[model samples]
Structures are given as C-alpha cells and as structure tokens.
Target: MAEWDIRKLQILRTLRDRGTVTATAEALHMTPSAVSQQLTNLSRQLGVELLQAHGRRVRLTDAARLVLRHAEAVFEQLERADAELAAHARGDAGEVRVGAFSTAVSALVVPAVTTLRNTHPAITVRVREAEAQEAYELLQAGEVDLALSLAAHAPTAADPRFTRVPLLADPLDVALPQDHPLASAEEPRLADLAAEPWIYGSSGPWSDITRAACEAAGFRPHQAHAAAGWTAILAMVEAGMGVALVPRMAAVPRDGVVMRELRADRPARHVVAAVRTGAGEGGAVGRVLEALRRAAGAPAHEPPLPGPARPPGCPVGG
Candidate 1:
C-alpha cells in the first residue's frame, strides 16, 4: 500500500503553481531549503520524479501533472467540506439547546424559536425553563448552548469563559390592586409607596431586584408576602394583599391588577443572552441570539401564546 501526505501534496501544488522553488517557498512562508527538502521527501515517498529543471526554473513533470490534477480535486473536496461545516455552524441545519427563566422563555425565547422555525427550519431549538443560576449551570455543563438570564446574575463581561449579549432592559412597573389609592396614578412615584406593604419573590433574582428597587426608593419594603412565581405574586396583588413590583416582561393585565409605570426609582433588570466564549459568533447560536434581540426590542402587547404542542421528551420552562 502507498501512503500520501496531504501537507506534502499541498507543498507540491504550491510549487507547481508558482513555477519556482523560491517563489513557492515565498508563497508558503517557508525557506527555499525547507521547500526543496519537502519536495525531495515527497518524491521519494511517491516513487516519482515530480519536478524537472528547465534552465533557471523548475516545471512539473508529466507524472507530477497527473498527481497535481488529482490533488486539485482533493483540494476542492476539502473546501466543500469546510463550507458545509460553516453552514452547519451557522445553524443552517443543526440543533441548539437553550435554557432560560420562565418569563424570558415566554417573552424572548419562544418568539425567537418561532422566528427560527419560520426562517431557518433546518435549525431545531430545544428549550428548558431554568432560573438564572440553573441556566448558568446548564450552560457551563454543556447541557445547553445558550442561556437567557438577568444580567445581574450573569457573569461579568470580563469573564473569559462566557460571552454575554445584552437583550433588553426590562423596567419594573408597579402592580396595584384596582381599588388601591394609587392604582389610577398616571405615574406613581416609588417613594410614595415606601410605606406600602409589598409582595415579593421569596428568593432568587426577582427578590433581589425587588429589594434593590425598594432600597433605591429610600426604604426597605414591608414584605407582606413572599411568593416564588409571577402568577402567584400578581394574584396576591390582585387580591389586595399588597403591592408588588413587576418586570415589564412578566406583566400581564389581569382583571383586578393595575400596572402603573414608576415616576422615579425606575428599576429595570438587564436581560442578556449568554453562551460559552466564542460560541455566539456566526453560527446557529449567533442566529438565535439575533432573533432574541429582535424579539426583545419589539413591543410585547401580550405574552407569547402557548408554544406549539410539545413533543415527548421536550423540556419546557424558559
């Protein structure tokens, strides 16, 4: 059996095109001696005289020409392979796993997925609902390709292990019971509600945002109730248990809950899409990130409709 080295073949091809050892060496960034040594080794390996001297220049022999012809085909095939790989990386056809928190899933991820399905059907997106910490864990573990999280919970931009792409600054609005004194206020001042008992998330990013916003308004909230999910928190507000701060992304107009924009101390969560360092550039991940940015920027008059029926084993949440 005969063996051929692709690197050596490449050197030979360069030599044939350049028509001189010196020119070939210059083209390949090799010393002339090194280029000659490679050609000598390739000739010995192939058992053929691949070059012939013609005065001050060298030319490919008939045997060398035959091999070069085949080498050209091999080069073309390799180029085609590279192009296909790039297409796959660009999400032309492949799967992207995403992890996101619930509101982000409803606000950003689902709309991005729907857009991808329409625009790039060959790319499949699998989603899982996870909180900020859980989403980061899933991303680090390689369980998901992208994570949507509050920027406060995401790693800093200087972190070399991940790329954080900002999607939106989702403002926190005041959720008041319809009959509350300030419910109809065009722009209720946060400081004015400093004495109001507040409903807040029991823990996690939402709770952190709530506490921080209240503190910025010059007082710690009188946390009347702690609930985990937005639905429950909103329900509590609707029942007049207490007022609450709701992120714009999670706000839903309900019968008894009136949402009012804050006049001052307008706190907002920065939402960002995160990926493993270098993963978000020019691939399916990049495409999905773009879709998310578009979805986040567009007005959301209503929450996303329920996503298409889930296939068995499909994870849901964000």
Candidate 2:
C-alpha cells in the first residue's frame, strides 16, 4: 500500500514545465528550498530517484517521467471524482461562487441569481467581480465554482481543464455624444467615425477589441482618452471627449450618449461560462449555467429548470 500526495506531484509537473526548481517555485509562489523539500519527501515516499543533477541544472530521472504520466491520469481521475462529488453534494441547493466582469455581473449573473432564487431558492450564489482573464484564474484556483468570461480571452475549446459554455453574442454599438454628427444616422459605418476621437482603456482586452474592430473597418482609432469603465467612457462620449465601441450589454441608455449600430457590421464579443472540466455537467453549477443561458436570452443548455423567473434587463461587458 502507498500514499500519494497530489500536491507533490503537481510541484513535479510544474518543475517539468519550468525546467528548473527555482522557476517552478516562482510559478507556484513557493520558496526554492520548500520545493526541494517537498520533492525530497515525495521521492522518499515512492522510493525513487526522481531527479538527477545535470550540468549546473537538474533533470528529471526516467522514474520521474513515469510518475508524471501516471500523475496526469491521477489528476484527471481526481477532477472527475470532484465533479461527481460536486453534483452529488449539491443537487440544487448549495453555495456557488461565481466570478464575472462587472457588466456580466449586472446583466447575466444577477438575473440568473434572481431566477435561481425563485426556482432553486436554496441555492446561494456568491458573486465576485473578475474580468475574463482573471475569472479563468479564479476558476483554476478553485476559488470560483463558475466563471462568466469573454470568449475572446477564454481558454481554447481544446483546453481539457475547463468546460466552456457559450452564453451570448453581445454586439458592440458605436457610442457617441447625442449631439455628434453621426448620432442622427440610423446606422453609421465605422469608417464614418475614422477621424473621430475615441475613448478606450490604456491596455486590456477592451482596448484590443476596440482597436481590432476599428482596424477591420480600415482605420486606426485615435484614442483621445483612456477610460476602463463603461460609465467613464460613456460619460466622456457624453461630454464630447470621444466615442467608443460599447457592448450591447454595457451600453446603458444614458441621456447624453447615443448608441448606434455600424451598418453591415456586427462586431461582438462572445460571452461564455466556464467550470472545472466536468463540473458544469450537473448540480448547482449546472443549474446556474442554465439560468445564465436563459438570462442571456440563449436557450438553456441543461434541462434542470423547476420554474422560471423574469430575466432582468441591465447593461453588461465589453
């Protein structure tokens, strides 16, 4: 009989990726000595020489590679077991920690929570505001049960660690001052606004998306001001500072800001819900996923509904 410490195996895997104990320690937020100690313990437990000194660096012994192969299998099985237990432990009633961008929290998560309140009243949803990239990190760290993220930044469909659920195709509309010239156009081509000043974040997915949309339209946006908040961006547009590409979910109806569609163009960000591999297949996570779909006006992906609540109308992400 043998006892295996999964944490030790994970450390070894990190070392394999980083190619050095110091690098692995940095990645895992541990001291290099601590990493060495853990691996030493693991080697003693398995009675194997997992590492061998190379020229000034260490290399994994053949035994280490073999252990890694089995370790991957063990990790997968553990994930599956976790999913099963998650489903079994919380059929429809449990706390679900959800991470999402601010806009998504308003437009999707809150509405879903309301729906779940009426349908699965016992389900408690704890919402954490996290952007697309950060949400993935939160989900990976097991700090969040579900993550609502922008599909543009979410991990690839082939990533085996997460199960992605497509939730919405949120279109972007050109936000301009109500008094701007193009404001009166029923639909303005993005090219028409090429000379206009633009409001965008200094750097981030929001900025990348806006710039990409502009480039696709054959002109670079003249970023006149940097603002990450939709509220700030829209306010700037209202004050005649600049214009911006505001996602439909985040384009709140401000009195001084008018949102206009770009003729013959639909630049949209895909919104998705992600869970740890198989966790979204059932249980509290599944119920929340279904509610989010309905909230986003998308068809429910799972048939876990007991009743329905009205979807709340609110602004959402970039």
Candidate 3:
C-alpha cells in the first residue's frame, strides 16, 4: 500500500464509526460525495476494496477493518504526541527514564529523587534499577537517558560519546555479624576477615574488587552466600551466615549486623552519572542529574565535636 495520510485514516475511522458515508459526512461537516471520493482514492492507493455498499448502508472490507484498527492506534499516538509536546513547551511535564545500579539506588537514588521533586516538581522521572554494567548498556542503547555508574577510579575521557559527571566517592566497608569476633575489633585488618565465610554480591566490578581485597590479605575467602545487593548481603551477615564487603554509604547497619571500615589501601570508588553525548542536557534528565549531584555531594558523615582542652599552666577543668 502507498504511505497513508492523516485525512484518509480519519475518514476511514469516521466511516467505521458512523457506519455510512452520509452519517460520516454529517459528523465531519463534509459532503457525502467528498467523503466517498476520499475513500475511493484511499482504496485505489491501497489497491484494495475498502468498503462495499449493502442496500441503504455501507460496511468495511476485512482488509479495511484491519487497517482501521491500526489507524485508530496511529491517531491516538498522534494525540499523545500533541499532548506531550504541549507539556514540554509549557515546562510542566516530561518523562525521564533513569537507570541506576543496585547500590546507588539504595544509597543515593532515593534522596536524589526527593531532591528532584523538591527542585523541579514538574518533571516525571522513572527509574530502573540494575547492575552498573547493564545500566550502562541500557543508556548506550537509548533504553535509558541516564545511568548511575560506579567506577573504582576516575574514568579517562577517551570516549566523547558520553558525558561523565563525577558525583561522589563512596568508600567501602566490611559487614560482619553483630557478635562476630571481628566485629568488636577496632580498625580490623583485611586479614582478620579472611577466614570468615564471605557473602559476595553477584558477579560485577565490585565483586571483583572485594575478591581482590581478600586475595591481597593473603587468604582466599570462604564464599558462603552470593547475594544480589547490599541488603541481601547484609541479611546474610545478620543471620550469621557470612560476612561481606560493601560500600560504606549503602551498608547501613541493621539489627544483628555490624559495619566497619575496610581499612584497605585502595581509594574509594566514585558513583557517577553517565549520559549519552547529547541526550541528557537541559531537560528532565538534566534536572535529575543536578539533584543526584546534590545528593552525592552530601557529607559522608557528621564530624564529632572536640573535647575541651586545658591551658598549659592551668589545672584541667577538674
């Protein structure tokens, strides 16, 4: 069939609705002969019988019925496009599809979304939680507009295809059971955790890093549970099934679980926002990125107040 036109599709739909040319013309404010001519033109273009008259009424051919269904959907899509365009023009609405890795979702994504709501309040933000690598792929495929990624270190600007924004460096921490021997040890070394059954997150960059940390400690960890995310790992730790090394920001202590610094020599990994070259700027995605930046820039921990000091010659405030 030749490419369809909006007017022809609308006329076919009107005929289907009004059941005849005369009634369709009355509804559309067009003459019956004009509507019939348009239908004939459409039938000629498609090389098919689109309609047939029966006594005082007209009905669609099977092919015409099928095409009309698709036409109805196309018109609905056009209407949606119009509504979305109007919303965009007014800056009152737009949809942003965002992807974030598991840890980032728990640690920063929620707060970031809250920040977005408080700041823009007009944009509709949809989030998909996935592993970092998967999320990156989704961003690359245009399935998502922005991805929250974790990098063990800063990324080199070798690829201009994406604009990488540094958000925060979230440090790693060791999760242990509440009463585990290592849990009570202040500044526990990585070696202290070696012999314990380790619960690792399912295979990923972070898992590699965790294993590397264990290998550096000179003992292979006993893999007890392989969980999906920090919460699962922590749940295992709380159940006293195994220990895990997790990002400090996302490894909040739960009942029966304890979190301590990793005390490793490696620098913290950065949680970053990755956007396709030209996709995320100056829209809902941009606003969301700003909100995430604000959340990631939040202080790691509250500083403690210092105790009062005594003068060199004075007795202590005793």
Candidate 4:
C-alpha cells in the first residue's frame, strides 16, 4: 500500500512545467531547498525515482511522467466533485476575486461590478489590475477566480488548464493631432501613415499591436517617441509629436486629438475572460461571466463599451 501527497505531486508538476527548481519554488512560493525536499519525499512515497540531474537543471524521469498523467485525472475528478456541488448550490453569496488589465477595469470590469451589485447583491467582488501575462500567472497560482486578458498574450485555445471566453474585439483607431491631413478622410488607411513618426509603448502588448498593424500595412513604423500610458501617448499625439494607435475602449476625449477608424483592414486587440477549466461552472463565476458579457455588449459611452463605430463626426478627444 502507498500514499501520495497531492501537494508533492503539485510541486513535481510545477517542476516539470517550469524546468528549474528555482522557478517552481518561485511559482509555488516555496524555497528551492523546500521544493527539492518535497520531491525527494515524493520519490520515497512512490518507491521510484522521479527526477534525474541534467546539466544545471533536472529532468522528469519516465516514472514522473507516468505519475503526472494519472495525477491529471485525479485533479480532474476533484474539480468535477466541486462542480457537482456548485451545480446544486442555491445562492451566489461569496467573494469572487478578479484580475484585469487597466483599461479593461474601466471599460468592462467596472460596469460588470456595478451590475453584480444590483443583481447579485450578495456577491462581493475584489478587483486587481494587471496586464495579460501577470494576470495569467496570478490565475495559475489560484490568486484570482477570473482574469481579463488580451488575445495577443493569452494561452492557446487548446490549453487544458484554463477556459477562454471572448469578450470584445476592441478595434484599434488611429489617434491623430486634430490638424493632421488624413484626419479629415472618411476612413484613413494605415498605409497612409507609413511615413509618420509613431508613438507607442517602449515594450509589451501595445508595442506589439502597433508594430504588427504597421508591418501588415507593408511598412515598418519609425518610433520617434515611447510612452506606455494611454494618457501620455495621447498627450504626445496632441502636442503633435507623433501619431499612435489606440484601442476604442481606451480612447477618451482630450480636445486636441481625433480618433478615426482605419480604411480597409483594421487592426485590433481581442479581449477575453479566463478561468480555470472546471471552475467556470461554479455559481459565482458563472454569474460574473454573464455580467461581463453584458458589460462588454453595452453601448460604447460611459461605463461598459461598444465595438468599433464609424462616427458621423470624428470621435475621441476632438
């Protein structure tokens, strides 16, 4: 007869995932020595070697791989047990933690929280602002019940660990100094800005969006200025330093900048709500997801936002 500690298996799984004891310790909030100690204990419990030294790192042994495959089934059944309980629960009366990016907090999560207050008044929601990568990490560590993430940085659709729900397209619009020539066009083509100096983040998703859009338009951008904050980027555009692409949800009226839709192929960032696979079936998580969908579908003004709109007059910061 043998007994297995789920905690030790978790450590082993994390080591398999992260490739180093240090990284596994960091992810699990344990010391590297503690991680090694736990794995050594796991080896004794299972009566098999679980890891082999490989260069500076360790590699999972064949026995460890076999154990992991079975452990995954054990985890699935445990989640199903919780799901069965949740399916029969009557009230949604517990705190739910959410992690989201800054802009999504304002445009999506805020409105959803407001509605949850009125509709499911017993539900208390806690919100944390984090970009995509950090948010997913928090999700994996079980710190948040849900994460609002972007398509560019989310896990692949096939990833078995989390469930992805499409929330918004959040089309990209060109922010121009009000006096720019193409600001007057019905729909400006991205190609027309090939020669203009660009303003974007020094790194991260915004820079990726700007670069991908421009390169797709058949030219590379000349980044003359770098700013990560939307306010700073818009301010630079207002001061006429350079043009920048902004998400529709993040574009706000600032008096000297006009936001316009691009002509043919418009670039956009996709937003999604992610939760651990079976956890999405719980009453609180399910209710919150419905609220997010409603918030995302609401009109583009004020709280909650709309998709791309072709304005009669130039919209945004005019």
lDDT per model vs. reference: 0.75, 0.81, 0.68, 0.80
Residue-level lDDT of model 1, residues 1-318, one tens digit each, is 446878899889778656789988876789999998998898889899988989988788999888877776675465445445766666377778999988899888989989988988887899999877789877765689888886666765434346677667777788999999998776688888888989986766667767777777788998889987778988999999999888888888899999998856656777777776556655576678788888988442222211122222111121
Order the candidate numbers by TM-score, best to worst: 4, 2, 1, 3
Misplaced by over 4 Å in model 3 are: 1-93, 152-156, 264-267, 298-318
- Which TM-score value belongs to model 2? 0.83
Candidate 3 structure quality by residue, lDDT tens digits, 189-289:
77877678888855766667677767767878777778766667788889999887776666666989888876554425666677754444455666677
Q: Name the better of 2 and 3 by TM-score.
A: 2
TM-score of each: 0.66, 0.83, 0.59, 0.88
**Displacement of the residue 245 alpha carbon in candidate 4, Å:** 0.3
- Number of the top-ranking candidate, with lDDT as the measure: 2
Candidate 3 CA-lDDT value? 0.68
Q: Which stretches of candidate 1 lie over 4 Å from their true place?
A: 1-91, 298-318
Residues 39-72, candidate 2, lDDT per residue (tens digit)? 9999999989999999888999999989887786
lDDT of 1: 0.75
Indicate the TM-score of model 1: 0.66
Clashing pairs in 4: 253-317, 254-317, 300-306
Q: In model 3, where is the ten-residue run with the lowest total lDDT?
A: 309-318
RMSD of each: 17.2, 5.8, 17.8, 6.0
User: Among these predicted structures, which one has the highest TM-score?
Assistant: 4
